[model samples]
Target: MIKQLPISVSGSRKYDVRSQFAALCYRIRKNKIQILLITSRGTRRWIVPKGWPMHGLTPAQTAAQEAWEEAGVRGQSDGRCLGIYSYSKETDENGHFPCLGMIFAVEVSSIADEYPEAGERERRWVSRKKAAKMVDEPELARILLDFDPRRPI
Candidate 1:
């Protein structure tokens, strides 16, 4: 788990960060683990399916919804957070703000041919190590590389 720290967003402003939920979708095949990644809408960087919190759903449930919308995949979420990773989110109004992303493990059970963002994003499944390397965020990459379901985050 990543420790919380005060981050400066703009001049004379510092605060503890909040986080969005992310689905770390994975599947076990032939004794190997494969992780699903999707291209970001703007920069096209590879990332796990993530989104802002939604009302009436828990964080892990929200992560599952994001997975289905962004990647056309659905699965069982253990309702446990795998880890947290800090990254900078660029915004037109805020310029850039530090955001923590809480990742929840989703064991993928199905993949559809079409999803809400099907036309806007491309999804791929790769080995965990390759998925780790493909993403630009160091903390996210580290989470993927050191994933252990048996251990508490």
Candidate 2:
């Protein structure tokens, strides 16, 4: 479910703030950690796999599912969320809504050759530093930069 915050007015209009779940899918490749990112279907902007909450799943599970559908990632999602980042989501009705994304760490085991959204999006594995720079969200980028699976969040 997309939980919207109390409407807030900026100028002459009001907007809702929703919360989403995202997966920070990563793998240890050649002894170095790499993050997987996918291009947004509409804008082709780099973003982590994310979606609204699922009824029968935990937040981590929801994030993991999104990773599977969006990036073809099979992995173990951490029990705890890594962090939260906020962005403005563009609506189909030509409006913008604020969204807070809870990011979960997913340690990827394998990537599938076929998955949902395969043709609609492009996925790539990149160095954390590069991934941090490629993403548009500042808070999400900061999370990527500070990521260390061995350390506590």
Candidate 3:
């Protein structure tokens, strides 16, 4: 569920913070945990698949959908939120807006080459520690550093 946080206003400006769902996609190979990172279409920065909430879908479901669309991931979400991280989303018309992204762990079963965003982004598999260092968001980095899929959430 999305939490309703208070919106802060600075003088005449009101900050509208929105919520998004993200998929922390991972898999076990050679007895090691590997994380899947994808480049953002616009900035080409390494990031997990994430997007705004969808109608009639739970947060975890939305996250899985984003993973399929953005990274060609075919996976199942654990249905538990790993954590929430804040970032500023850039837009052409309204500048930047604050967003809270709730992360769900997805144990990837397979990846296809011709998914929705195949032409728009790049995908890579890396160690969790490397992924933590690759992302710009500190909170997300910490989450990646501390995440242990074997431990119950």
Candidate 4:
């Protein structure tokens, strides 16, 4: 099993059988991050290019897969993982799927003209300032705020 770092918020913490997913938020031309805002078939508000892992791939590799699956963008994600954030979901009203996400810096030379999964969801290459305003999550916003294209990871 992969070791997960314990997360704490206002004196609460979590861990279990399922795991936190890792993903990359890609930057297309001119250091703009590609962000997707939408719901799962299960319906939850989130901003991510994410999914569960397949056996042979590492979390980072799985992140790359999710990027392609969710965003229809292809590129090299050789940047180092910067950090993690969490969000919660539920299949049923009372139960929840609390998830943590590791954010990585990714680069794309090109984006596909169409995304297979873009239905009802909005996708864009947003400037860091615009991205910060688009999301409610402070953590995701911080990632965009601290995003310096000229700096090497």
Candidate 5:
């Protein structure tokens, strides 16, 4: 499993950054690469689904797992690394992450019928251009651009 770095989480206590990670995933449908965007509970902040890591999983595997849990979609991954980004993690209404987050590339393969975790979230398939514009984070928007069909990650 990837390392989880301890950091100040805004909600109730310190959170481990290294122990958790985030991921962005894509699926090609109708000749366009569609990115999956999610809405989190409470704050309704538009972001990708991500969470703590599990044992015996690679960072990419962890990312793929997060997609399944958070977005209800199953995906494979590209050998090409889309690279990492950082965010502060928190467990509160502000919805700000209180720790630095690392990002990875995951390829969408299938979406399950059931949502096993928090249903406080919903997901949608959108164009890379629209997906990039949906988030406020520049680095995250840039990550979406990297997934452009014409732009190789």
Candidate 6:
């Protein structure tokens, strides 16, 4: 279910902020951590896999599922929210809505060559620093810059 919160945009005008779940998929390579990023389907912008809440899943599970579908990631989520980031989601009706995404860390085991959205997006593995710069969301970038998988959440 989408939980909506009234947010003041400018003065008295208000907007509904919806909730989303995202996966910060990562893996260790050569003693360094690499974050997996996928291009957004509409804009082709680099972003972490994310989606609306699922009925029968926890937020972390939803994030993991999105990662698998969007980036062919096979991973296990830490089951704890790493952080929350807000963004404006563009809609098909030429409008936008506010969203708060709860980010869950998923340690990737492997990636598949073919999966859902395989033809719609491109996936890349990059350092956290590089990934932070690649994404457009400032809050998400800050989360990426400070994330340390080795530390307990």
How close to the true structure is residue 18 of candidate 2, measured as C-alpha lDDT? 69
- List the candidate 1 regions with Cα displacement exceeding 4 Å: 1-17, 148-153
> Candidate 5's residue-wise lDDT over 75-152, tens digit each?
765534465656555564445654544666677777876877546687888888898898766777888877664564
Between prediction 1 and prediction 5, the one with superior TM-score is 1
Residues 1-153, model 4: lDDT tens digits: 234333333332333324544454555455445543334444534466766545556566667666667776666555356677766645453487766677765565566657777664445666677766866568877876687646854
At residue 92, candidate 5 shows an lDDT of 47
State the lDDT of candidate 6 residue by residue for 38-128, as single tens digits. 9999999999999877656778888999999999988988577889999989867548888898999999998899998999999999999
lDDT of 3 by residue, 1-153 (tens): 344332322343223437788999999998889999999988999999998776567788889999999999989875778999999898676788888999999999989999999999999999999999999999999999898898754
Cα distance off (Å), candidate 2, residue 12:
27
> Mind giving the per-residue lDDT tens digits that candidate 1 earns over 1-153?
333232223433223335788999999888788999999998999999987776567788889999999999999787777789988787666777889999999989999998899999989989989999999999999989887555555
Count of backbone clashes, every candidate in sequence: 0, 0, 0, 0, 15, 0
Model 2 stretches astray by more than 4 angstroms: 1-17
lDDT of each candidate versus the true structure: 0.84, 0.85, 0.87, 0.59, 0.69, 0.87
By lDDT, the best candidate is 3
Model 6 residue pairs with clashes: none
TM-score of each: 0.84, 0.86, 0.88, 0.70, 0.76, 0.87
Q: Name the candidate, 5 or 6, with the larger lDDT value.
A: 6
Per-residue lDDT value at 50 in model 2: 93
Instruction: Report how far residue 37 has shifted in candidate 6, in Å.
Output: 0.5
- Pairs that clash in candidate 4: none
Worst 10 residues of 1 by lDDT: 5-14
lDDT at residue 139 of model 5 (Cα atoms): 78
